[model samples]
Target chain A: MQKVIQFLILRINFIIFLFFEILALILYFSNNPYQGAAFFNSSNAISASMMDFSSNTRHYIELQDVNDKLAKENAKLRFLLSSKIVQNDISNRIKNDTSTIKKFNYIPAKVINNSTDKYKNFITINKGSADSIAVGMGVVCFDGIVGKVKSCSKNYATITSVLHQDMLISSKLKRIGAIGALRWDGNNAQMAKLFYIPRHLEVKKGDTIVSSEHNSVFPEGEMVGRVTSINIKGDENFYTINVRLSTDFNKLSYVYVIKNKFKIEQDSLESLNNLGKNESK
Target chain B: MKANDIVKTALSFMIFVIFHVLIVKYFVIGSVGLCFFYLGFLLTLSLSIPIPLLLLISFLVGFFVDLFYDTPGIHTFASVAIMFLRPKIITLLTPLGGYDEIDEITISSMGVRWFITYTLILLVFHTLIVFLMEASGFSYFHWTLSKVFCTTIFTTFMICSFQYLLFTPKS
Candidate 1:
């Protein structure tokens, strides 16, 4: 008994070190900040307040850029509104019924913290569950798609930025409707790769990429990026195409959280269809 | 450690943490190189600090850093690892006779060559663990290697410069 006690006492340092090492590893492995609790992340009250203060300080320095972008976006929105009005007038005349259900609600939120340099970058916004912002909701800036809401607290939420390695945006070439998956290559912050587009399809540089209707997270036809380069290997069936992202993640200030009204219903219906197929098989 | 030494260490701990979270966090040299100046606090601690206490302090400091970076355990894991290996490294790099009267590991106290070697070994390990865990795989092997190399150099330069500029040897 005495020998055992002495042995344990002598190796206590190693034992303690092992304990903390294990604890830290557990936290690391379990840290899926996107799906897990928001306590340890920037969405927590204390960190969010610090981020808010820092962002407020930075806001003034970026005022000119923000104003310019907002003005340009305003002109685009005005054009869109004019065309939408014309379509609405024609539809109204064809159908006397006035009921038109709203599909998406945009909740405006200010970005409090953002990073574009890391392998997996995330953005923190100043609105959360309190503002009806929930996980999996699509976030978009005026220029292009931002990301999806990963987790939320009462007053802050973190977004898995488009630069993240694991983030895959379902996108299609606007010119020819060639569908592909857009993902960051973990190197460039402004460029992403479009995969699964077959080599036979006609593709060219400067073609626009937009979000596809296949994903409920983002609305169809949302601008994603423009193709900068394309490579077609002799052996591979798919072309390796590079896209220049439209939204400058470094300058992200304000974004809108999109709430899809029929998301839950659509998901359930598709899941039920899959279940039936499985049972039959 | 003396009471005064403890107070100074604690004060420096706060300064390093705050500086790292606020200023150094944004000071990235290119996309690949990131300087983690918070490790400067652990690196310069009095050589006599016991392993258990050193480990605990590192864990706490790392946790504080992780809270702000939104990366929960990555920093804590790397910090505790370096602190745990610090004593072994000191013993390995001990002079022929011994450390003698040396109290802390700083460029002024340990000389430039010894300090560089010590800092390089520990910083490389620290950067390796951080980047590897961050990438979570060997998929980005080349990029991760470049990042590790650049970040180690960047962090070593930052820590060494801070030590040389700010730390005044005891009279």
Candidate 2:
């Protein structure tokens, strides 16, 4: 009887092991990461409290990296609000003399977790649905573009990092004005490639890339990256320019969502124009 | 069966989870982080967490670690595989100096060499799961080789160092 009980206990333990492991596998393949996200969120409150207690009790050298990231973001904010530099204006040369400032609302949130080393990477932010952060909004850390929101529940949203292949940002060279889709080829974390640039447009190494006005997602002239090199060949149809992202992607912490006040109105006009073009066809 | 054992296990698990949250998730240094995150494996192997409980905690720890990193299922697979292999590790590393089954795992009891060997086995086992899952398959031979080499070196050094820190000297 004793031997049978011990065997039954061992088998039960194995069954439990299989159950938890299988649960994890099922989560991996499932379309719903939000389920796991929810579990983490609930546990975070408890874990964070525990860490607050324990981390203080332990010796940690990792604090330096977080400090460095914070310092860079602080420097970036100072530059953004600095009024010393003259605005670069090709158009409205006379109107540029009007010193009146335009006010734009900004939302700030810290990135609790993010990833850039995979074929697909996501970012978990401290802000949530209640914070007015919604789907399709753009996230920017430092002066560079981060990524767009993919999913949002009540208290959190999963942002697809710019490192992911699924991400798309309309970007252009600051000097040449040549526009293309800025994306990653699933290789390096610090590098991305600009595609669809016409050969006629002059692109050179060390040129700056910026978000275009046409992209309602971002304000025009926001710095995206610098053109590290351009691959131009006789056979290729597009000039693929390699970009070195200005913001250190690995150390991202704080970010602000680029919410355009005119997005709703601009989107309606664009849809209307597309509908008319379709009707004529 | 002692109450102290249960408390120790719970405390260790909580520490590993917190380590995942504030440190490993936010800060990364070229996959060197697979080291600190392996604290879960170290915690499991260092003590005699019953095999069933070991697998359960390992799976949760792995899954949670992967979740924070935006990885799907890689952490869970790696952790559970190591958790399953830990009993064999304990037996392999059982002290020739002492015949008694040591309930508590500490450097004072196991010594540095045994600890290193023990950690190396768990790290290799844990790292293999991570490499295989991340590499996906053997289709890209070069990638598989790199991932294997990278994970092995990284986990071995990391797990051993963590063990050294956790075990306080009795003197």
Candidate 3:
């Protein structure tokens, strides 16, 4: 009886260890779906507050770089403003006969926490549902696109960065307008893979790539990256294009979250169209 | 454990967790190596602590770090695995006199060579598990391996040196 009791006790230890390990594995895998509200992620109030404090301490050193970026962005915006003034007269005449309306709003947010080292890289921002930030909203920086809002708590939100393994953005060649999809290969944080361009299309290293407006997430012609290299697979009809992402995620701080005013109407209309097609069938 | 030892352990635990989340977490080497200095908290625990208790301690520690790292269960999984394997490793590397005389785990208590070997084995195991899980699979096998190697060497050096420089065996 004594021997049996000791044996059972030993088995119990292994059982408990296994139980905890299995629980950890379940949490790890469930994070992949991008919908589960994870309790332990950095966007939680406590974690965000901790990171906010840390970043605040280092904010002075980072301030110079941030200022430089803001100045450059200011210059670019100034140039755009000057150019727009000249074109405004012509645009006004054209606009009087046209019905084009703005459909996107931008909410600026500060990055409280970010990591570029992991395969599933994420960024935590200071905006959340309280600021009208919602999951699936697009995030962009001054340079170009950054990521999409993944999850949000009361006052913080996490971004699924462009560097993540499963993050795919629809993009197009700037010069030729050939459409393709961009995805990270999980190797280099600076580079990503652009796929689905046909083999016959003229693509070259250094060709610029930009976001396609077909997707509701981003404005058309927003710079995504530039082609760094192109590989042709013999069996496939598409060329595997390598792109150098424009936004440096390592230095990312300030970003804008895109709110599509027409998203609800667009989604409802698309679903209605689908329903109508199904009923017609 | 005596009151003094318990107090010291609590003090060190707070220092480790605070240092990890506040300072070391930001120090990444080339987007590959991550500094998990809080692991020393678990590594330095008294060998006499029960296996179940140690596992629970590691889970909570890892979970706390995960909250700050935005990694959810990655660190927790790695920490628990290393804790579960800690006893087997200690037994395998037990010196000629055995673990009878050992109460606490530190470089001064275990000798330099023995401490290095022990720390290397466990740190490497922990780093491998963490990098692999972070990559989500063998998809980035070479990248993950390099990260494991980089982090193990960095963390082992840091932990062993910190232990050697500061830790003193308590009677």
- What number of backbone clashes does candidate 2 have, counting pairs of residues 3 or more apart or in separate chains? 0
Question: What would the per-residue lDDT of candidate 2 be over residues A190-253, giving only the tens digit for each residue?
Answer: 8999999998877888999988877777777778999888898898889988999876778776
Q: What is candidate 3's CA lDDT for residue A118?
A: 90
For all candidates, state DockQ relative to the true structure. 0.28, 0.19, 0.21
Clashing pairs in 2: none
Q: Measured with DockQ on alpha carbons, how good is candidate 3? A: 0.21
lDDT of 3 by residue, B2-108 (tens): 78878878987987778889998898888877788999898888877778888888888988998898877889999999999888998899778776576788777
Candidates arranged by lDDT, highest first? 1, 3, 2
**Cα lDDT of all candidates, in order?**
0.89, 0.70, 0.85
Per-residue CA lDDT of model 1 for B21-93, tens digit only, reads 9999998978999989999898888877888999999999999999988888889999999999998898899
Error of 1 at A257 (Å): 0.7
Give the distance in Å from residue A56's predicted Cα in candidate 2 to where it truly belongs: 11
Which of the two, 2 or 3, has more lDDT? 3
Please give, for residues B1-171, the per-residue lDDT of candidate 2 as tens digits: 577777776676666567656764454446433444545444444354567767877777776677676777777766777677677667776666644667666556767677667766677666666665555445566665565566566655655565568866567
* Candidate whose TM-score is highest: 1
